[model samples]
Target: MDLTRDQVEAAVRALRPDMFDFAYWVPEMAKEYRVTSVLYSVVSATAIAHDLSPGSELGVPPPGYPSSKVLFRAHDAHALSSLSIFYKRLYHRMTTGLMNCDIISMRTCQEVEGKFCDYIARQYQRKVLLTGPMLPDPEKSRPLEDQWSSWLAGFRQSSVVFCALGSQITLERDQFQELCLGMELTGLPFLLAVKPPKGAKTIQEALPEGFEERVKGRRVVWGEWVQQPLILAHPSVGCFVSHCGFGSMWESLMSDCQIVMLPFLGDQILNTKLMTEELEVSVEVPREETGWFSKESLSAAIISVMDKDSELGSLVKRNHAKLKEILVSPGLLTSYTDKFVEALQNLLNDTNLE
Candidate 1:
């Protein structure tokens, strides 16, 4: 609930101008609290109201204390994926608007890299500072294999295709049905972690009618939630069809699977563009006039990417290996963080830094 109008006005008036320099640890936290729009407006307003010069560098940090490193080392995909998305959105906003902060974006999306580089070059006239698409070390991730094996049961070999979209976006019904059909066309065992649309009860209702039985045991498994990182790491997962959210993209890449990009909204389209254009890690699926994906298009995209022997698949695998190496390296992220903080401190000391 909102405070009284007088209270809000007073609070606004009392807003400390120095808070403009304060970093937001996680942009997604506002979304969790259902106050994302409000927070966005407040930050924009405060910047405008105070005539605060946008800082030369925005020093955005991923959520939590450095101890998250030790705490989450052997954790599931969910934790790592969530933090990655948080950092991405935070950096995007910092780089985009009047706030004018240099963001430490993870090097996962080509779009983020492109926009950040352009912002640094054309806008800030400087070099961009990037962290990693920080990966859990392979040695650390290896121990989780047996645990995932027990969770996946019979689908433990190289048969399953893991499908996941990130937390922010949802699919319209038509899109969902088309995706179902695409899975059917794959002729591979699939596990899809799909959140239902705003009001739908079962995916069966939202998916193409009779679509469930069409694939039955051989081709499909659908749930509102699945252990995605586990699914990605599973030996059975042959491919990934994803929304190109940085989290899913990183997980899938680290899994060494071929990817098909179906970007829906936000920076995702940009991320997908990067995945296709710069990194060559995946193929882009076409969206129609209204930016919706259709069954025919989805089917074609899926078939094109899933072929193990295809040139496109080989290119994707090669690129993923390169990117994955950057992500899983030890102390790489810490080094980035140290450099970022040093940059920020230097900027704070220089009046003409920006």
Candidate 2:
């Protein structure tokens, strides 16, 4: 599979193989579990070698079996290894680079093949299954409702925007400061749910000096984490400025707030692709090489999204209502799970019969 340049560097430093030949040995292990060894790739693209023989790509197999070259679009590395004994099912769904339409039989997106691949993956590990956001059911979620409303009561009327940057990725100081300044420019109350930067004593280090004081009267609050779902659901939160992480996208969409996106790294770019091009519900900030976003640009994006007259806002709200009808339905999620289990059971039975 394609490994990002960053991922490759990490592998080189951590694995520290004595020779390049060490790479191909992974596929040999997969053969023992009925996996057909194919090409060895780098960065999920770039095929390093095809059906590389012993001593061809790798010097020799290790004590264990060769690793399978599994790809799951939505799954993190851990989820793939956990779900199937032989196959790896990715938990999320998105395009993985471009695919060949001319090819007779090949799938493009991984979500389509996730369960099937997961079945094969189970033949190897079969311990961990990739899962989606296990959000609390809206109907059953009670205390959460009260807690959310209580938090909302503190915000100034029509002044707050909820900001969260998913679970991964942090902003550098310049970016954070610019973002804060943008909030200040809006002259509205704001809630920034920020995770601290590495080795930093406080979030204020990344913020402009006097920012906290400048925005003091208008209910500017910052914390390492907030009950994100509840925050989005709050009536006072008129908009969302986010990193466009898929989970955050889904959360914001369901809550019916207009969204301004600032995506960082990996699938985030692709997620923005769908949001801006496909869904038409959100706006994205332009990112620079220095990883900095301008306060002016941020301010503009925020103003546009927050504007009630903007067509995008109404479109987002309408799309959100429709999406909620599907996403919040217990039947949809349960059906997917039920299908996954049935497939697994059928595969297991065949293996036993064999």
Candidate 3:
């Protein structure tokens, strides 16, 4: 009723570039047109990129799915090469990913250690450009952004801290104040994105009295949310204080910012451990066996991540740079497609004759 089909198509094309996670969606569009050669897609109400011959749309979904697609990496293009070597023992628990049912059969990962997919069918991880947490509405993001630039202007590159726990992570009142005090003690320039606790209207209400005045002119305090990628990518932001949500972690790494992990819950705890132990890209705030945390420990964590002279800090800095290099490499996305095509060819058992 509003526009002709052509007009609608043009609008979609024009808007695609600015869409959320547009980078991932580009490949999705390609698959829609059958441009992708490797991943078998059976298009229905739900789009399923199956573990089948490249370009193979086998009419109907099998009962369990992927009797032919190899489950895990038989090789490393960061692509899933083959199916489970352990299918016999876990067959009942596992089933083929049904696209209509909202399952990603597999994906590529940046590193071997990165999570690819879930356990049920076949899944893995690969780096893709994240879409959210970019610059906020220019009109709304003003004055504060200007202030960040001004505050960071005198600092050296990779020097300041940008703190933004995602919207989901809310701190207890005492914990919030403790961290605020810690940042104040660091004396290093920082931007804290504060979210109000449940039952609170604004973050300021949770502040310990005079805490704002104490840190006034010394640190930057922001509202419930900010354009995190913008802050992380800022030249002056060397360290990121976060709750270690996977998206935030990736954004930080992509922006070349070192992590100061303050994990609050389940996967976050595991993620912080992995980022520290396996990737060596972040340092966790110290805690005791009883899982107690202190303002002193919080302060020390900020110092450790930002002070490159310290040993762990130095190691984290190097890893941060390395991760950034991998994330922004021009060839990374191309390689994901290339690997899928290669795997698809293998599945069809079709090779070019020499």
Q: On a 0 to 100 scale, what is the lDDT of residue 278 in model 2?
A: 53
Can you give the lDDT of residue 41 in candidate 3?
A: 21
The candidate with the higher lDDT, 1 or 2, is: 1
**Order by TM-score, highest first:** 1, 2, 3
Please name the candidate that would achieve the greatest TM-score relative to the true structure.
Answer: 1
TM match of model 2 to true structure: 0.61
lDDT tens digits, residue span 284-325, model 3: 777754464677887899888777679888888888788768
In order, how many clashes per candidate? 5, 31, 14
Better of 1 and 3 by lDDT: 3
Q: Alpha-carbon error at 327 in model 2, in Å?
A: 2.1
Tens digit of lDDT per residue, candidate 1, span 165-252? Answer: 7676666666676777777776767777677755677766687778777777656545455667766766777778898766676677
For model 3, what is the error of residue 55's alpha carbon versus the real structure, in angstroms, after optimal superposition? 34
Q: What is the lDDT of candidate 2?
A: 0.51
Against the true structure, candidate 3 reaches a TM-score of 0.60
Give candidate 2's error at residue 181 in angstroms: 0.6
| Candidate 3 least-lDDT 10 residues | 73-82
